[model samples]
Target: MDVNALPAGPASPGHVLEVLRRGGPMTRQELQARVGLSRATMVERLDALGRLKLLRTVGHQASSGGRRAELLAADEVGRCAVVADIGVSHVTVAVADLTATVHATRRLSTRQDPDVVLQQVLSLGRELLAETGRANDFCAVAVGVPGQVDPTSGANTAPPTMPGWSGTWVHDTLAAQLDVPVLVENDANALAFGEHLADGAPSTTLLGVKVATGIGSGVVFGRRPYRGVTGSAGEIGHVKLASHQERCSCGRTGCLAAAASGRALIRRLRSSGARTLLDVVRQVEQGRPEAVALVTEAGHLLGGVLATVVSIINPQQVRLGGPIGALPEFVAAARAAVLDAAHPVALRGLREIAPARLGDSAALVGLAGLTADAVFAPAAVNALL
Candidate 1:
């Protein structure tokens, strides 16, 4: 393959790298076939990527009767992302490769102040990168907060659960600390993205609801999160319920989250000495009468919001996630309510309501993936080459 022979306008090294990133290792013939490029063009692009240390030969694939083709893969070690899943109660920091392979991880109790939380994520991210021997390999940092973010500016806006987080300039602060690009996402949206990537990058739309300290939802449509015009598309926590009069963190009288969130249940059973949502889950599993009743009711409330969500968007799969959402009893109750409340037409395309596949790590996985995609876009690849 001659570098001088390469044409000027349409040659894309990114395409080859993207194919390898998404589909794993591939032979030259497979790469050429998939990209529909001439063999010479493919070879030139591959060689260029190799010189830039962005692609490498993993192994050789079997051949019919000719020389075996070497399998090419993205040199994920050359670039990675630091991800932080900032929950209401905890912070999970991890370093992941471009393929979303987690290299190192750490968790800490969340801080109440916005700046303190940002510092915790940055410090932990740096520590994880060093532990993974990838101190300078990361291209971006991603953080998923349990609150709403302004889409264009990446500022926290009117966060109900996270005190002192509202109007915080999170993206700029993290970017300044890490000296790299920063992506801030809502926690539930991160979970949905994580589920999407873990589920073999499915083409169908998905809805993931996180029933943690608060209730929030994430939606995936056409391979992108539906963040809506205001970037608060999935703020189901503030959905007003006429029947419940509990005061919500958002200063509302009857929000569904106040009535049905994990925190809500904990508050209801505050006298039982349950410190975390997992304790409540254990009680539910052990068939404790009070825990079962509270979780079931919470599921019913969540299902009401989900019924409206399903009716409007009609996602193919609905994933219940977080500490409380994964419980079988809660899922069953939510499923029944969804089936009862959703319109028949909306129900036609729906699949079974299932627990989130990634469990508590979904947000971290999603943040890593989101970081990778942003850093590996065509323009970024061209710049690297």
Candidate 2:
């Protein structure tokens, strides 16, 4: 159910918490099977978790020719987290429970100053907590920003779209302001994790591509993001293109994002009154000849880059996400492009191309999950006991 590296018993409270958090409602017998804990030991584990308000008993499961078993789930009603998804021009904030369910959401423009933006996040979080009557029950604050980050430190190593953001102490500032565990992640990685953990998700290993103001991506394998050595594993936006010659925000020419990203589209379509990424999507959906032609080219460029990625990683699917990622035409175009460019061997058994379903709030949902996992790891849970 969850990533369990700990011994499966009361001795490892993290294992028990993580299992319940990811596996959802299940009888003690079913949970015991997954964690390999004896029934007697399971009682002790559950009791400890219960005291910490980390697990709970829901309604009873239907009896199968025997006594009905009480369904137990990770308790989320007692705690909450504040999460934010930061994009080029806006931020989506939410309050989520231990189970990563959003309770309230708000959207705000991205402030030019990081401090102001983070302050806004804190203010919004406080407001949400008060409204939800969990003002003091929120455990952490997390955000997904679009840039290369030092995952552990949560500081940007470089800023492509955001000028003067490289020096901001994103994690430390949030941690200090909120006085709780603060997590910062690449927006694409957060989206990938959200997609990976989605209910009824068809693939665990996949690529999450963001094609909004900029193009970025993340690789998730077995529910863990592959962030390379310095947390820049999936910067497909900056990969050079033989066919593209435009300049990128990163000061590079011939990058995929320089040619195919939404910002690029806006530049190319300014004469046609395209303003934001939404405008670009609207144009494509309206079947504007110019927009369709441009997006198709961008889609092919994206797919061409993804083909190389697929060859190396062999992902089950390439999940297109972000604002433009919601478009069906772009999804189809990318799918066809991948099929046309990728080797047959790599394409074997690859699932059909599909638009990401998590929508615009994908990063927020993921940050909440990450918040739960990190703040309640085995060691943290055991410490609580």
Candidate 3:
């Protein structure tokens, strides 16, 4: 095996690393077969990667006749991401590996101010990184906010739920602190990506809706999230209902969130001692008359928006999350409404109206994944090499 034998261009060291990263540990012969590289080329790449301490022999495989070949892996010795999932009520910070394997995590309540929330993320992220022994690993910083973001700059846009967040340079702020690449994503979009990963990374389109304090949705087209041109692809909560003229937080009338979101529901049940979305969900589970009525109506309204979503995009899977969306009763109502209102052709490709597989941790998982991908991508690897 010789380094000079490896051709230029696509046969870069990054290519060999990517193969091992995606396909897992394999013998040099197996890797050569997979990359269709000459033994000399393969050995050169392996030697290069080995010198960089990015490739290593993990174990040995069974042999046919000669000595067994050593199974080699992309030695991701200390790589990890510091990630945050910033929700309306709380923020979850964690240190995770490229596989989204969380090593340490913490959750804390926070105020509405973007500065306060981001500060919380910064403190907790550093704390977890140190706790998990990933403090020195300079990977990416990914934060998922419950709001819209600029696709290119990763700045917060005009998010109704997060006032004063619009135009905020989330990327700059975090990048200044952590000194690494930063990714700011809508919380629902992060959840969507997390759910996509949780479902074995299916090569099918998925729509993920979160019905929390403020309703929102995320779209995943097979591999990655669909941010759309304006970075508001799945604005399900803001869908205007033709029947209702209720004022939405976005200062728009007839938006579905105005009529059906947990915020709206809590406002209606304010005098009833409903302080949180969980309070409303408890009532629904208890079968309280008002709670059941309001949630059922909300479910129908949510479904109506989803029906339009289904008709337009026709995703293979629809994952409902958050406190209200995950409720079996609410899901049933929404499912029935989608079935009734959606076009037959649209429904043909649909699977089930399922609850999110990752639940509360979805956003964190997604953020970590997004961070790891950017940091460990083939291009990134090539640049490093």
Q: Evaluated with TM-score, which candidate comes out highest?
A: 3
- For model 2, how does the per-residue alpha-carbon lDDT over 1-385 read when each residue is reduced to its tens digit? 2223335455476787778767868898888898887787777777777767787788999876888988988776667899998887888899998667789999998856867987898899899999988887889888888878875555675456676556447777777766678778888988887776673463468788888898889888866778887788998989999877898888879999888899999999999999888889889889999999899888888988988888788878677887776577778788888898887888995775677767876677778877877887877777665
Model 3 bad stretches (over 4 Å): 1-9, 51-53, 56-58, 75-77
**For model 2, which pairs clash?**
14-378
Q: Candidate 1 regions off by >4 Å?
A: 1-10, 19-24, 33-40
Candidate 1 local distance difference test against the native: 0.83
Q: Best by lDDT, which number? A: 1
Instruction: Say which prediction, candidate 1 or candidate 3, comes out ahead on TM-score.
Output: 3
Question: How do the residues 148-172 of candidate 3 rate in per-residue lDDT, one tens digit apiece?
Answer: 7768766677456666666656777
Worst 10 residues of 2 by lDDT: 1-10
Q: What is the C-alpha lDDT of each candidate?
A: 0.83, 0.80, 0.81
What would the per-residue lDDT of candidate 1 be over residues 50-139, giving only the tens digit for each residue? Answer: 887887789899768888878888887678898888888888889987777888888888756778877877888888888888987878
Score residue 295 of candidate 1 by CA lDDT: 95
TM-score of each: 0.90, 0.90, 0.91
Give me the overall lDDT of model 2.
Answer: 0.80
Error of 3 at 171 (Å): 1.2
Model 3 — which ten-residue stretch has the worst lDDT? 1-10
